[model samples]
Target: MSTRPAAGRCLVDLSAQDRLRSRAPERAPMLRVLCCPPAGAAAGYWRFLVREDVHVLGAQYPGRESRFREPAAPTVEALAAEAAAAVAAAPWARAAITPGASADVPLVVLGHSMGASVAAELASRLEHREGIRVALLALSAKTAPGTAEVASTGAGTGAGSDEDLREGLDPLAPGADAAMVRWLRRLGGTPEAVLEHPELLALQLPALRADLRVSMAYDRFPAPVGAPLLLLRGTEDVTVDPGGLEAWRPVSTGPVQRREYPGGHHPLADHGDRLLEDLLACAASGRSG
Candidate 1:
């Protein structure tokens, strides 16, 4: 893989009604958060979460963000492993190295949607394989592994062929057509230019296909995880089935807690503020749950 410079900050002009935005604190922070985006999505999508005393670091997977110039990983396990490596090597390595952070502020993992599983797997890899200690894990939208009762991990709503992958993803992308763009607008997956650019489309689809494959063929972790796990879901979430949530019971080694929102599939976005409060509350109240 080739090395590329970090994405240079660029300014985008948007209407107040059309633009998505978040506020970051202007001073030093106590805790730093490592955030991972959902599948078919890029890093920095969670820019809205930066706030007072909180520094949010969004993990950029290969094939997206500055890593877009590099080759995408072929499997979820590979991707998860790669992300774990990056976290171990980050500039703040001293803050949350193996065995947990040295400071009082806890090292937290907040993964939304597909990110929930990705985050869980990352924590598992770090602790079980790499010997890193994760203070707490906040998993949103996705159920615990083996818990998604209404949905199966393998074979998504989209067909398996690369061509089908392109077609299924095109709608979630930005520029297919007014109708397709509208569809993507609702999904909130990619940027308008990416959906319109063929070059970027070429870069994104293979990675997207690989992630879907990971989702489908993914097997549960060999054993239950030891970290405190908090599961969040939406009452109206189409992708998260109740049976799926129930399935998570057997896979977690620590105490398991569930929080359900009143919205659809994307519960975090629908209940971002409430979700953030609950996550912080959960992390601050205890050591091991």
Candidate 2:
């Protein structure tokens, strides 16, 4: 794992001012989004989801921003564990619905690609440890756990061990930084400076591997999560492969809204308002108030 600051603290600082202003007793958020980023991506990647209707919280793993100084985790489990710890430590510990209250302040958790798996695990952790109910668990672009056979066409399929993730990243190193930079360029993320800086890669390498592990090895809980679920697939997404969406049907007890958008995997990047509208629409009138 790459070492930086805590992922939770960075998110809190980045959105603190806006979050305070958006808080209203009647109009408080019906959902608190905890977006997990795919391999090599950071929490800010989902900044498009932030709005007045929902309290959006994005988790920045180690080696990114405030947490950039901390060593990154090497495995997906470690990353999820870190995320689970962060969620547990966060100040907003209230359950989706207040105890004995008729109105359930729903929490809609959205994860894209690898982040989707982490979101599911986090939700499970929240349910088992904190006993908080997840109103909705939205998994996009990635397969739900125990459904790895469907992801055979992906670049690196199946749950990966720590050694597997380490080996996967072994091809790039001090000598292959240039090749890595070229790869990052096509990925369309990461700053030029970060790409050029050897030190930064040293920090990011762990995060990249950890993210890949999280993506590869994530398993959905067998016992159905006590929440509505959604699976969003981009018809054109060639990277993650949309095969997993079909498998979600049997698992989702509540309304399972599966959408096939025209764009590639990251639909929110091009269809921010549309996606936000869909997410916000899940909020009940009473809950939104």
Candidate 3:
């Protein structure tokens, strides 16, 4: 468990002007999808994913983007708690259940890499505490918790020197001082200009390291989540082995399905249409569940 900030302040507060951004607002949305970005990324990563039926809201973590001044969340639990609260208090949540509107507008949660673990915890919190039933819990490029432990005990704990941090990112990127650049190239969402600036990279390190620490140290929840789970993986993803994806089957009480795309790790970039189709189908099923 990592140290939490004082009350009334959090690393990522959706209520803040820049934390939770709407990607598709031109048309009325039948469902709302809250997306969490991969490690070292921000909410703007989902800007390209526009759909009329689904309103995409990106969750912006602190120590990046507009919240660069705020301290990053020390643990995944803390980040999840804050995110859950923000969702519960969001205007969209209220509009979804307003009278004369749709009976039950679905709320889908999607995440990638470290974001996947955070989404799991957020879904659990929302279901248990806020009585909000998530339509779908979609995860990508991440192994199920409690099955395979992320190497958090040693040098990968985010406490090592800058060189160690660069080395740890080698698998995801595989280069030297260009660690951030390589990672962006592989992730396929971040802007090239952001990676090119040394000042921005310096500002991003704390949040990235904190995210890594929480992800590495995360433990599986004691109980299975109630929402249907969909696992997406890339055929070429070296970070998450295909064998470990099946572990998600036992972690959800609802239906569990796994699919592999043609690319590696970042399926949304290479297979956005297929991903969107599957996501919409899953949300429809959740509405009828």
lDDT (10s digit) by residue, model 1, range 141-161 = 665454333432222222222
lDDT of the candidates, in the order given: 0.57, 0.61, 0.66
Output the TM-score of candidate 1.
Answer: 0.71
Mark the 10 consecutive residues where model 1 has the least summed lDDT: 9-18
lDDT of candidate 2 over 1-289, digit per residue (tens): 9553454554442244466676633346655677777777777787766666567777677667666666656655566566766766666655442554544456666777777766766767766666766667777776655665432233223553323333445555444445455545543446788877888777776667656655665554534566667777767665444555656554445666666676655555777677766665653422333
Candidates ranked, most accurate by TM-score first: 3, 2, 1
TM-scores, all models, native as reference: 0.71, 0.74, 0.77
Off by over 4 Å in 3: 1-25, 95-103, 149-196
Report the Cα lDDT for residue 71, model 2: 64
lDDT of each residue in 39-76, candidate 3, tens digit only: 77787666556565556777777777666777768777
lDDT of 1: 0.57
Off by over 4 Å in 1: 1-30, 97-102, 143-206
RMSD of 1: 6.6
| Candidate 2: RMSD to truth | 5.3
Order the candidate numbers by lDDT, best to worst. 3, 2, 1
- Which is the winner by lDDT between candidate 1 and candidate 2? 2
Best by lDDT: 3
Number of backbone collisions per candidate, in order? 10, 19, 0
